[model samples]
Target: MRLAETVTFGGSDLDRCAAERKDAATLARNLAEGGQVIVLWRGKPLVAGDPAKGACRLVRLGAEDPILRDAEEGAIFLGRIEGQAIFAMDISGWTPPEPVDEAQIGAFLDPTVQLHPGAPEGSAFRELRAIMTTLTARDAELAATARALGNWHLSHGFCSRCGVASAMTEGGWQRLCPDCGAHHFPRTDPVVIMLITRGERVLLGRSPGWPEGMFSLLAGFVEPGETIEAAVRREVFEETAVRVGRVDYLANQPWPFPASLMIGCRGEAISEEIAIDPAEIEAARWVTRSELLQVFAGEHPEIRPARRGAIAHFLLENWLADRLD
Candidate 1:
């Protein structure tokens, strides 16, 4: 899509100094010396400061009013943000005040806390994706990293093999079992999201409980040992009874809502039969490029365009502009 990479978290070529992961002390010292500055508040990063100018603040743990922390407990050296060294701190342990109702979460969801220290944060912090355009590329990548690693710790606290509690290791990337000596690493499940086209028309589906009129590309999790092409075809067929052929990988996005890597593809539909799988989807149909254009423009009577920032939207926008090829 012409605006594919323009989505939230689209990416800004942030330096992710992966080569320095092994040297924690040097990296931490480098960060304290004021080279990089971008911190995440519940996964939303603060991109407003100038680290090289020493305009950033690092709140010590247990300090009076600290909004962020080192995300890995150890430093994960994020490359420079406009020539400043960016380091992410994981503050996943902090909990917020009790909520009286849903509206309370609104105050808790503000993005400014990323810039300010301790404007009241929460334990359920996640990667900041909604306001991606306003964030720097360094901040976006750090937020994604924080969300992915934190989720791994949450879901894999217990070992699958021995049913024992696992300890964080490898700078929060791996979990080690003390009882059985088993090693576990963070997981990123693969999902196939495809724009299935049959000439001028494409396939779209709406899952149960989504907003009315909302439709998106057919998607499903890739089965174990399955190839990307196979997963695309299988998911499309199983959901809508549409046989897809000639799958071509288009793009990919790292979705850290508990960790998923969306594999975007363009698939050619061999048949146009509509047989919705009741358990998986509520409705499926072929939508012409013209109709999709209307939906994108918010003029369609029955179907709404996919949510912004989602891979489906990216694919559809590109397809409509004849850029998906």
Candidate 2:
């Protein structure tokens, strides 16, 4: 796991200026003084330029741009990159001149060439998952942060303590409820995605709705008051009826399909028997290292490898190469 952070969406060590988030004067000055902003529309990021050249461009606008006027809430500070202030704003209500391509709007597990439409003149609203592997570390992290924060704001407009609508505050980092005096921050659901290994094989499962032949490391959300290790063990048992022991931390990835932090781990499976819970997964099986190599090589007929940018793929790839240290 030494190279774990080198995974996609993992290496950008962006300086998230947490203390300055609440400072109105600093944020205003930053915005007015050459601060660049990333635009999010309905959770998708604005990308322009060619992805083949490692320039899957993240559309950035200045504070004076007219589009900033249409932002639904205050810009959320996304920290600075080499002294340049970065922020994210929501423009979900803006009307596009063209219609989005319906055929290109579904879930794609593998990276495919895409042509997006229905965006502003120069940019296209691209699904981050599709192009995550092609983006630079900086761009990937920024897009993930923007999408996660924006999705949280969209879903948590009301206070859970009272049935009162909350107002965006703290530079869009927090919401304030007028009636209940309750303050809410953005939430990131923690999920444990473990690489379960029993001797020479690893266990993988396919969800009910996934594309044919696609399988990935077993994962589940961490329940309330549960530790990461406990969650990993419980999730493995619940989904495939496989008892896991000796769980060890591997790495993590920011999965922004509505804001999740995937904690990757390696586990020792004590019980090889699998009784897949149909409600949780469609099927489960064990694959040897040679079989996994075939899957990655596109030679396996029964299983497609995990999505490229996902932590599951990262873990499995490293494990197969005997580099999961």
Candidate 3:
């Protein structure tokens, strides 16, 4: 695999059985014959261990598990692993035993965990960001797939072309509008996250409402009629007024926080000066290579490295090691 493909949520090559999704008979056979099942709540995947500590992984359940009774809209076929058909279900309908921290549910990285009374021992629905790094490549891919697909179904129940409810077809891969014959597939918003470098320093910015000391590579959604290269330069300049000369694609990650594909890129910034747009970002600054090392080592007094398991952190680490090739 290429070094770029090693980024979290990228390397896994699970076999997504597209043809079988159309075969309802085959899908039923797989589930009846014991396919691997994954359960999700809201956007969180059911994980087995505490991610804050060591040794955490996604929890896979059997098809006949009682908790499947609470699954919303039945099962979603989430491709295959080796020879086993993997399926997922969003049991958002399942309520918890007690009250939950509503504030944390929508935070950037929700630290809160919810335990379902019907789930397996030690299994709880935890935020994917909170436990992404701890999951194996296959588990991470499955979790991301389940979260992205489930969320898409939640918001896109109605057809865009006609004002009518669309039914999920092709084993949850598509939504067909019964009224207008409009077929809508899952949506993955394309985003550009570029590492803008000027000499030995890298440009970093923090959003207005982000926690103190949290900074990452400048990113923005790719606008219509925009190429990846153009989007990279535009986002960097718009946020920091730093002009970028040459841009190259590096890696890509599937960020399932409301479904986005983060396209990682590296840009050579021609301007050293930073002019932050308050509306775009709260602060923008350049951090030296040496200072970045301190930030990663937790020795920097005022700066925090990008969150682990994110493409930004992966790109920065590779850059620091001189391995962005």
Q: By lDDT, who's the top model here?
A: 3
Model 3 lDDT per residue over 1-325, tens place: 1487777888586899788899988897898798878898898999898676755788888888898888768678988877888998888888888787788887877888788887889888888887888988888899998999999998998999987999988999999999999999998999999999999999999997677898899999999999999999999988989999999999899999889999999999988888988999999899999999999998999998899899999999999999987
lDDT of predicted model 2: 0.86
lDDT of 1 by residue, 87-152 (tens): 445554554453323343244233223223344332223225444433444455556766676556
TM-score for all models, in order of appearance: 0.78, 0.92, 0.97
Predicted structure with the largest TM-score when compared to the true one: 3
What lDDT does model 3 reach? 0.89
Kindly report which residue stretches of model 2 are placed more than 4 angstroms away from their true locations once superposed.
52-54, 100-122
Pick the winner on lDDT between candidates 2 and 3. Answer: 3
Candidate 1 vs candidate 3: the TM-score winner is: 3
